[model samples]
Target: PLGYIKSISFICYPFAYGNPNKPKKMSELEKRQIEKGDLSCLINNQQDANILYKRIIKLYHQRDMVYLVKPKTLRYWLKSIALRDANEVFRDLVNSGY
Candidate 1:
């Protein structure tokens, strides 16, 4: 019974166990892309995506009492914040363009 329950939990929350097959090192170019406002570079695997999803949900609940704003809105807000904090060249370009 315990083993069965554990298997079910694993199936439901695989990301909690972390991904063993993910690469241990990222190239310098990848790091630079992430720093330059590429949000997708932040999530290298399913575990990272799950972790980010949970964090977004937690932040949404903490910041609002009513279910007015969608989680996607929070995601864009986070992306904008990250982009603004990126290198001066990227920030200046984004600011001037938008």
Candidate 2:
């Protein structure tokens, strides 16, 4: 029982408090694409955008402590950030003729 509790806590504690050392899932190419402002790799179409929007929400819900305290507020905050970032990326794509 003690071991089980330890293991569960180990898995859950990171979600309660952000993990600074968490490994990023992004590949090198993806990193490069983001840095270059070419988000085609991340969002190629409306479907991709929709999927990514959901993923972003899920990611924040799982990893952000603020989300645990206030789910609605976190959702709104994340939506605003996503919209701003998406607009910037879309502008870059348009300017680059993509």
Candidate 3:
């Protein structure tokens, strides 16, 4: 349907739209760090984790292709490690009242 096609197009178009001031691509290390951050926050259920995951995925690959895996695998991983780390940091932050 036209709506579906447009939805796909909307999702797909950003990789081609570059900001002139920004570099065309990020280094692999930078990308990995980003994914690590997302994983941490997602595990913790941090407020920004979903947004971070979406951005990190977008930075590295297309959204549609990323979903070929069984659903919820990434969520499980996030909960396992990243979430725990995020919770510890958040708890420290709150306890410190910073």
Give the per-residue lDDT digits (tens) of candidate 2, residues 1-98. 00111121111111222355653343456334334543333322345534533222122323322111111234434768657645754564468565
Candidate 1, residue 22: lDDT: 48
**37 in model 3: Cα distance from truth in Å?**
22
Better of 2 and 3 by TM-score: 2
Q: Write the per-residue lDDT of candidate 3 for residues 1-98, one digit (tens) a residue.
A: 11111121112112212234543443456444533443433222334636423222222242211111111334533546555644654564468564
**CA shift at 93, candidate 1, in angstroms?**
37
TM-score of 3: 0.21
Judging by TM-score against the true structure, name the best candidate.
2
Which wins on lDDT, candidate 1 or candidate 2?
2
Q: Which residue runs does candidate 3 get wrong by more than 4 Å?
A: 1-79
Q: How many residue pairs clash in each candidate?
A: 0, 0, 4
Write model 1 residue lDDT over 1-98, tens digit each, in one string: 01110111111101111244542343456334334543332222246534543221111111111111122334534667545433433444457562
Please give each candidate's TM-score: 0.18, 0.24, 0.21
Off-target runs (Cα >4 Å) in candidate 2 are 1-77
